[model samples]
Target chain A: MSAAGGLPRTGSALAIWPALRRSGLGPGLLMLAVVTGLNIALQPDFFSGASLSGNIATFAPTILICVAQAVIVLSRELDLSLGAGVSLINCVMASLPQDKVGGPLGVMAIAILVAILLGAVNGLLVAYAGLPSLVATFATGAIWFGLALTIMPQPGGVISDAIGDRYAGTLMGIPVPLLIIAVAMTGWAILARHRSGRRIMAVGSNPQAARDAGIPLRRTKLLAYLVAWILVALGAIAISAQTLSGDPRLGTSYTLASVAAVVIGGISLGGGRGTPWGALVGALVLGLVTNVIYFAGIASSWQEFVKGLVIVAALGFMVLEGQRRA
Target chain B: MAFTRRGFTSAGLGLASVAALGGIKPSQAAAPVTIGLSNGYFGTEWRDQMIDASKTQFAMYENQGLAHKLIVQQAGPDTAAQIQDVRNMIRSRVNVLMIDANSATALTGVIHEAKRAGIPVIAFDQAVTDPYAINVGIDEYDWGKHYAEWIVAQLKGQGRVAVMDGVPGHPAAVARRTAFMDVFAKNPGIKIVWSGYGMWDQAKAQAVMATVLAATPHIDAVCTEDGMGLGIMRAFQAAGRPVPIMTGEAQKSFLLAWKKERDAGHDVHLFARSNPPEIGRTAVGVAVRIAAGRKLKPLPDNTYHYPIKVEVTNDNLDQLLASVADKPDGYFLGEYLSESELDKLFV
Candidate 1:
């Protein structure tokens, strides 16, 4: 899969492929193909308008979280608190005084600001206090959760119509959210080639070495977390947009699931290597796998079990591919 | 690394063990039939309402809903924790066990556990697969069917309808939608332009409705499961169109909406408090009864299913709220339940 690019690709065209294969994307793709075929054979309306839209709409938040998680893992840090951040943002966004968030514009801005602030806190603790990202974020995440539950004991509020109206529809038969993700990917792909981007990779690969090279290690780590949190915030908004209300508990699934997806997408847990694209691909695959399983008329209860299997398969495949390359 | 895992395991086990230790609350000398009441969590006002209702009925003692000793526990939406809680309840040898099973299927073991002890397990809000649980729960099909029935009847069964669904794949959502769709299916005039699960939240209701409005503007009315009915109305209002909206769960929010809308002279109809405090009262009753060696007949086996009364117009809304407030005990009690019904329910 990596061989298409030339030498300027700077590594074995198969450099990324090894991980993709390891991540089980190849196998995942194969299985998905099989599943798709079987599902189509079983149900003709599986690709119908309402069904497809519903699937995409249901999963947009999860996908965005995956992308945010990809960034965090690539920096060789884990934001165990991603879910907490998202949940808090969801609550805050939902609780925005109705008069204030009068439209999508106000809501989006506040949501983005909250994400950045959350990201900054994570970045500051890990970078400045020198706290282990795990402990710091985990503790903060707990606090975040406590706060969320405190705000709205139950689900409340309504998202204004502006969000649901503007972005929910399909453009040329593609979901507007997916289009937004595509644009996000395009911008990220460009950044992936820059020197600072390489620095992020270097820091992920070996922060000590990056520091020796005069790279701004703390700043980079901060940036990465901030970036991740920012995305989380955006993801929260997307979710908020989808729900049109802020559910205090809405982001719980994303907290653990995003990390799982990032690792499954072939991002190293030890950091130093991976791509936003990898996370994006991984998210899509997970989404597809989930949707396919659901639409295939399987008992809906198997979702969690299937999700666990998907994670195991991705981790297993990645290890095998890494070994094969070595 | 291993220590972290071991630590987590131990910490989790400790909370469980401590919870299982039981007898934290005061119990009577007659060993007030040891009772176990498993709640979902203490986070929401709904759960708070249940707790409040339980305490009130317990204090009243008319129906014996209380235990020689009552052990109230929260699973917080965790099926595993709830399962463990049920096990703990059994291990402690509670007389009668009343549980609101986290997930209906997962409670079979706990239900069986209660049964093997000769303890009758009564389920409220949901039925147990164990078949022993007297299910004192609202029928989801009826819950949804009634809401839909109300909307259809109000619209003369001919208006355009947009629906906001509850959490996807929830039995409640499915039953609600299914029964509703069955009714609406009868009337071809009601065009459902937008229908999707809101996952039972205010935001989702708003967003889903917003999208629906975007897709099919100027629709006649909107219907959704409670959780965010007002949220849905708010979304519709924000969009500069206030459609006749129908939903249930007239808890604090809906009650408040009832008051506001009544003052405004705009009819805001809510199908009564769907998560009635009465259900909580019944659940406690069943739990205490089994603990006291009383018969668990009629409550668990037969579903006390009824169409929730719908309150429309400000006057009716005020009247409903007033009645619920004025005669909290008898007025809220499920139809035909006796004073002794609250006997075992008290501790």
Candidate 2:
């Protein structure tokens, strides 16, 4: 059966299968494995239950944001505001009275709604208003950060300790953060099977061709953004749970980090080529690089320089792999 | 990996050098302990100085066999990254954990984790809001009050003041802002003509001050934190406006500027205090004592307020200038509590 807009596809073959086989997932996963091995060598207890859980809790937000950026990049667009969006949602959820909103669940609903609205704003600007996603989202990011600062100027607000404990806790011998990541990946899996998902890739792959093939480019982009922002909202919630408080600048490092993860994940920044799972692996690779650096006892001053060098090496490897494939 | 091997070899070489320098065997009274320092946000010279001072102190401890290792993990201004750094420290089984926190409230969970792992956590430079962590830093509120009070007195309880602050949401900056605003609010005559966040950055402060100078017809005094004082002075100088009475820090650049004004026969009314980065060294000393099982003197709120003792006024400008003359412009002139002074903090 055709997936969308008469795109050729077999009924049994899933869209993600092609994406997984075609993109940078292999190299990204390989990089993650190598880094993990190095980390384990330096830190023998790297995979201890407590250490694993703690590491996953710290990594969940970045991993989710990487997937969020991947979704937008896969649609031939960008959302530079995802990090700021996380900060804004974090402030909103932490500052608002959970009791007034009918407790934790309601607060979460509001956060998700805010995330969708933020994504829709970017979608409308990029898809409907025809503004460059780069410039459009950059402006919106600033606005979101400003709004976040307005909400929580001094980084003091309370989130229930229960939430933080549960986030750091384990469920059925599996870390809660690991479960959250699984849920996100599962969500992406379902989306990859959807008609809108195919349309997003089609639009990103070649907008003119997609238009000729009768795909609603604007709507598809909007849907892509909405999906991506939902993921970001989840990320924001995860981070809030970890922090257990509101800070407007908590997500400041995420924007560039997300973009870097997408590139490292072997997703072409030009668009339409990589899977969110590849981005997931890329995020893990980045996290492990940090772990390895710390465990290796690199000097504080040289840590950043070393991180840069490692990332460049990863990117160079991907380039060489891509060239050989071609 | 080759990198891991090299890291161990260098670490080994460092220990050998420390042993040679010390010229003494490891003490048997207390076993040498590993100390971990997790610092988030390394963008400024102040942070660099803090880390350097901590390393210097750690090496001294290593030489004395109080500490066998000092593992430092410095990351960007991301809470999660810092938390991860702290967790890595815990996993490495450091006997003590010292943190220069990025966010006061955000690190509670991780600090708890460290405590549960039976590691004593000492937060310095910036306090964390965890009950489990012992806070060691200057009283940021009083630090701000000193600046505000001095500025108010110089203005004789009245003047148009332009207030330049550090990062708005930063804990230290927030405390300082609250103190300044409270003092300003109590006084009826002090009018705040302009205010903005300088992000604890000199260039950003300079730009903000230049804009304030352009828009405001007159600012009787500029109340600012350290690190940005020199920039504010330059802003006034560049605009060809007479430099006003201002607050300053112990940074060499600002101190030098104050001296230049005094030499030029310009009476510069400045109050420069030392928010010493050497507190990093002091915190290490405290951590070592705690790890040695020394009980600390009971304190209110589990907080130790390092005294803000060093100040540069018109009175001692020459002496302070001469002391820091050989230092770099970014050098912060201050002192850590000596080992003897730290003894008073423990029972």
Query: Among these predicted structures, which one has the highest DockQ?
Result: 2
Model 2 captures what fraction of native contacts? Answer: 0.81
Query: Alpha carbon lDDT of residue A108, candidate 2?
Result: 81
Model 2 ranges with Cα > 4 A deviation: A1-21, A310-326, B1-31
- Give candidate 1's TM-score: 0.50
Candidate with top lDDT is 2
Tens-digit lDDT track of model 1 for B1-347? 01111211222342333322332222333345556677654555556666666656555553443445556666565443354456556655666666765445545534644554566566777654445566677788877777788888878878877777876545567778898799899988888877887777777777877777777866777777767776777777788875465664565555666577656776655454354646676566545443433332243244445334444444466666665674432233223234554443222
Instruction: Report the lDDT tens digits of candidate 2 across residue range A97-184.
Output: 8788877778889999999999999999999999999999999999999999999987878887777888888899788889989998
Give fnat of each prediction, in order. 0.00, 0.81
Q: How many clashes in each structure?
A: 36, 0
- lDDT by residue (tens digit), candidate 1, A119-223: 898899998889999899999998888888787544555566567665667788788777767766675666678776677778898988899999999888888
**What is residue A297's positional error in candidate 2, in angstroms?**
0.8
Query: What are the per-residue Cα lDDT tens digits for candidate 2 across B1-347?
Result: 01111222232343433333332232354456899999988868899999999999999988776788999888778887887888888888888899998888888877777767778889998987777778899999999999999999999998999999998778888899999999999999999999888888888889988988899988999999878888899999999987899997888888888889878998789988899999999999888877765556677787899997898898988888788778888999878998778877865
Native-referenced DockQ of model 1: 0.02
Considering summed lDDT, which 10 consecutive residues are worst modelled in model 1 chain B?
B1-10
The whole-model lDDT of each prediction reads 0.64, 0.84
